[model samples]
Target: MTTTAHTPPAETPPAQAREQFRAGLRRPTSGYSPGYAQVNLIAVPQAQAFDMLLFAQRNPKSCPVLGVLEAGQYSSELLSGGDIRTDIPAYRVYRDGELVAEPDEVTDYWRADLVAFLIGCSFTFEAPMLEAGLPVAHIDQRVNVPMYVTGTDCAPAGSISGPLVVSMRPLPPDRIADAVRITSRYPGVHGAPIHIGNPEELGIRDINSPDFGDPVEIPEGWIPVFWACGVTPQAAVMQSAPELAISHAPGHMLVTDLPNDQLQVP
Candidate 1:
């Protein structure tokens, strides 16, 4: 029941666009939905939601969950007045293991048997990282974090399996250990870097051209550090290809009611 904005506005203020996007379900969400928790969105048929939710629980570092909606329900009441069907800016539609479409809204594909999921994203942890004087490359470059399909395997669920996907950030070798420690405290948002160096070991052939997102420049004194990304679910969904699936498009994220500070494990 929501209208989609396929073409991003050329001159709208970031805050206004973010609000409009929050009103629909857009990922890679821009501007700070100030004070709101931005989440990764995933939707599957009723039959798979359970297994997917379990997969998320099993892989908490990669899929830290904030909430899940019941089948046929669009509202993520637990996370707030978020309407899963429309709050995200864009969504990927899947069929039989292939990406069929990326739409601004999924109202047309709405199904009575669908369930929605809202998982935590690194955006929450980046706030602390910046505050701690650590730099986030993607933020500095104004682009989505570069992600790659790694050689690491995820703990699998029924018919759902794939290599772990990681988002890369360049860090000074000296600050590497601290970045790991600081991010580890927020396990709910991909707590720490999985691999700190050598993209080749992760099956990534070219660091300049990542599998997803634009590459950021790696300067003289920095090393490429990677974190488990929220996009893993989308990749898994595409690979598994259950009938009639929907997910937030890369970068567009679900804005939730939880505070970013709450993601930290005391």
Candidate 2:
């Protein structure tokens, strides 16, 4: 999936990608629809909506809110012409906080009382990273990025709370600053590196064994850069043991109509 500086790969349009997913194509979305925004999905019952919203408000780094769909809603400006329940590549369903199923489409499991939250995803910034001549290891290796649940705890909100989760990318020492500057522009998309260097400092015991997503090769001399992940809410749902929750499987995302640059700051 590596692309040249000026000539990026042929990107699939946002609507077409959604159509493919709607037709049941399953895969991680890191490089899909390269220039459009991609978001993490977390849907919960109406009763738990406020707690989830408060949780996101308290943990903005990991769960920056992009858009929200009220109870019984399955579409919005972010996902025009698509159904939230079935447009993603894959979904994880949780009952009482336990992951009960991983399905291609959740029409059978989706509830009318659910409220869906679209949170920013790091994938939204990967194209910029690649365009900047920085290597994105997971895309380079054709695997999903590695993610770990750090020992650090997020500030609790109402009944929702959990440890912070982070996605990692290994980069050369010389390029770290460029990667940071390129990514920092898009704060709505979990902007910037939260921690750089040793994973142990973030309480990650084994860099090779990630709690979520597939691990990619870490070339020698390349250091790991960690970014707060949208998966944080899923972690909260599991720890708090909510009665019902639906989320995109780790690495799988909802590609949206919005352009990536739309989230960038000056």
| Best-performing candidate as measured by TM-score | 2
In candidate 1 the C-alpha lDDT for residue 41 amounts to: 82
Cα lDDT of model 2 by residue, 1-266, tens digit: 11111212368998898999899888888888888999999999988899999999888899999999999888998989899988998899999999999998999998899999999999988888988889998888878788999999999988899999999999999999999998899889888899999899899999999999987799999999999999999999999988999999988889999998899998
lDDT of 2 at 154: 93
Task: Supply candidate 2's per-residue lDDT for 52.
Answer: 93
What are the per-residue Cα lDDT tens digits for candidate 1 across 1-266?
A: 12222332244433454468756434455335544467888888888887798888888878887787788677745445556766677778888768888787778888988888787787777777778899888777676667787778888888676668888889989999989999899888888888888889988889998777667889898999988988888778867778877887766776666777777888
- lDDT of each structure? 0.75, 0.90
After superposition, the stretches of candidate 2 with alpha carbons farther than 4 Å from their true spots are 1-9
Would you list the clashing residue pairs of candidate 2?
none
Q: Report residue 208 deviation for candidate 1 (angstroms).
A: 1.3
